[model samples]
Target: MPLTITIPQEYGYVLLCSTATFILSNWHAMRVGSFRKSAQIPFPNHFATPEQIAAASGDRKEAMHIFNCAQRAHYNFLENYVSFLPALLIAGLKFPVSAAITGAVWSVFRIVYAVGYTKKNTPNGKGRIAGLYFWPTQLVLYGLAGYTAYSLL
Candidate 1:
């Protein structure tokens, strides 16, 4: 007898969430690249060193802020995505419906985080507060997904 698995509707939602996260990551990276170009940051052999990045934004406070924010947003996504992707995959496979919902929620949090980080002059400390609120929620979701997968093994 062949082993069989049934995919649930929520799996599609998880996929959509994953795609949205990817798009957000790409947008941050593009923003960084655009800032670098606009600032005339020289890229030696298409790669920027720390020194090069510093030099590129030299004496320009706003330019440095933009570059730092963009870089932070991009790197933050990359760091989180490494853990999120595997957790999402395992959760979607093991507990599709709940995992997918969690994944979607996490994605929304991530978007908020990115936007908060990138946008200028958000009122009432909204941006920072948004990120602070969502980050732990996302981490909890990842932990739950991981634990669920581990329990199944």
Candidate 2:
């Protein structure tokens, strides 16, 4: 017997948000790769060391600084994405529409966050501002997850 699993139609929004996030994630990685080459940071190293930076063919200081920021931005997206995906899927089990809306909000703000981060060279830059709005959305997803869990009990 072939068994079929039924998913909620509202889940479509989650998938859309997920796709957008994937695109954003890919862009961040590509930016990192491009900057890494310009910065001449080697395969195993996340940032260019002093000697490596000094030897780079481009504007050494700016190239290294930009590459470092790109790398950090890419990794930061991955860090949050991992947790968000599982929580979103779980929350969708009971509140698909709500989960998707919150997820979409997060994905949108993530772009702002990443763009701000990549554009600014500082450790804490304007990118952090967008993140403040994302927290409330994440909290809503968590609340939905709790509802789903309680329903399953």
Candidate 3:
């Protein structure tokens, strides 16, 4: 067997899509850093404690909520990445173009979800519209991976 593995040509499409995906995740991280600064949430503390929230003024409360949203948006991407990366890998091996296109769509909606989620008064639950649309692309990636696996068997 050859020591070096061959890279598939279509893997480039997967790489580009993965790049877009990570850029979105990192952008959220940068946003969280800025929000943390605005909220005066120092390092070693992920977020304001309940007591701190209770004692905060109106402006501080608003800042805290924004920071919380930024943190949640970034963490939410991390949660999804667990599945996205693996599924992208499995599906890309067999269907790179389709996988890449869907991945791009997924990344775009995640941006929409993050933007909406970071809006103030999110307790109203109106910010989940983008989240609602996020599942289909993910399911498709999973479906492709599943189909690939089944075909190989």
Candidate 4:
């Protein structure tokens, strides 16, 4: 006899959402790298520091702004994703369908956040507004995940 494990449909949705998130995150990172290269910042030997990037930019304020925006977007994604991933996993195991739907929502908002952050000279504070929407939804999703996991225990 062979041993088998079954995962719920909701969990499958979570997996799909997670995959989408991973792909989008990497795409943003690559965009940042492109910005850095275009700015003529030397690619990191091991790790590139803010000082090193600034030194490379050398009086090019526009280049510096673009580099900074890209870096901010990258870091922001990492910060949110790190915490969100585990919560999403736990929640999906307990409340798969809802968790998966929430995860998808979170992923979409994140994309909006990144685009808002990266776009140059966005009018009417659009990027900041988008970020405002993103944060609350992210927080709510994390909370829902935590509550779902806790209820199961």
Candidate 5:
């Protein structure tokens, strides 16, 4: 579609956030493989796919579980962020600074969440703890985006 909004500054922030998430998400995915290769542990021969290599070598059901958790959390991050983009675009046009800051905050929280989640070996309260960082980021984006949507209508 033709351009409907203009906010280069906010767009840049949003794009940067998206790029950061992409890098972090892919890195986590690769770490799943890397952890397997270095595990020196073994799994049943049946578990020999590229994905299974990590699980097998590490004998780390916990690590495997963490990776799965990360995948889901990152997916949720993407889901919420993308959902807010349209609202952000509109919001940025009107409240560029707020929107940009919100986007930046969102990216930061996601990165922190990934770091905290990945470093730990188990999935006890770590996920919940890291999520504290993640939620505000999402909330900021949603708040700003909502404001923009409201202003546009």
Candidate 6:
């Protein structure tokens, strides 16, 4: 059999996807930091803006809320990307095109999701929608990878 460990074209695409995600994550973090600096306050852990704080409370509460949102988003983004990267790599070696396509789809959804989540203070509906739209693509990639592995047995 051919050498399976050689880098595949799909792997390169997946790498691009990973790099894009990292850039976006850092970009969002910086945006959050900008907000915090502008507010001249510490960050929050839940909401993304102090404006989300209860009406009864003051600006500090709102700022805290925004900080919290930023923190949660940052961590979650890291976790998701890390988990998916290895999977992409595995799939790439065995099923490069599928892996690359799935990675591309995921990257697009993530970008949309982040913008929707941050700009409108809304839920991740757009992102979720994109995810749903991309599910079939991901499944196809996963299936291809699994098939490749099974064939080797």
lDDT agreement with native, every candidate: 0.65, 0.76, 0.83, 0.70, 0.58, 0.60
Candidate scoring better on lDDT of 2 and 6: 2
The sequence of per-residue lDDT tens digits that candidate 5 reaches over residues 16-101 is 65556567667655654554454432443212344654445444654455555555555565677566556555556666767767
Sorted on lDDT, highest at the top, how do the candidates line up? 3, 2, 4, 1, 6, 5
lDDT of 6 by residue, 1-153 (tens): 674556765467767765776787778678668656644554443344435455425655544555555555555567676656666766777777677778788767656555444443344323334334434555565676677667656
TM-score of each: 0.70, 0.80, 0.88, 0.76, 0.62, 0.64
Query: What lDDT score goes with residue 65 in model 1?
Result: 50
Ranking by TM-score: 3, 2, 4, 1, 6, 5
Those runs of model 2 whose alpha carbons end farther than 4 Å from true positions after fitting are: 1-6, 50-58, 120-126
- Indicate whether candidate 1 or candidate 3 has the larger lDDT: 3
Mind giving the per-residue lDDT tens digits that candidate 3 earns over 11-69?
Answer: 89998999877788789889999889988999978876767777898988778877877
Q: Which residue pairs clash within candidate 5?
A: 36-54
Q: How close is candidate 2 to the true structure, as a TM-score?
A: 0.80
RMSD of each: 4.5, 3.8, 2.7, 4.8, 5.7, 4.5
Best-fitting candidate, scored by lDDT: 3
For model 5, the stretches where C-alpha displacement exceeds 4 angstroms are 1-11, 33-59, 125-128
Q: Which model scores highest in TM-score?
A: 3
Better of 1 and 6 by TM-score: 1
Question: Which has the higher lDDT value, candidate number 2 or candidate number 4?
Answer: 2
- Tell how far residue 128 is off in model 4, in angstroms: 4.0
**Model 1 stretches with alpha carbons more than 4 Å out:** 1-5, 44-59, 121-129
What is the alpha-carbon RMSD of candidate 6 to the true structure? 4.5
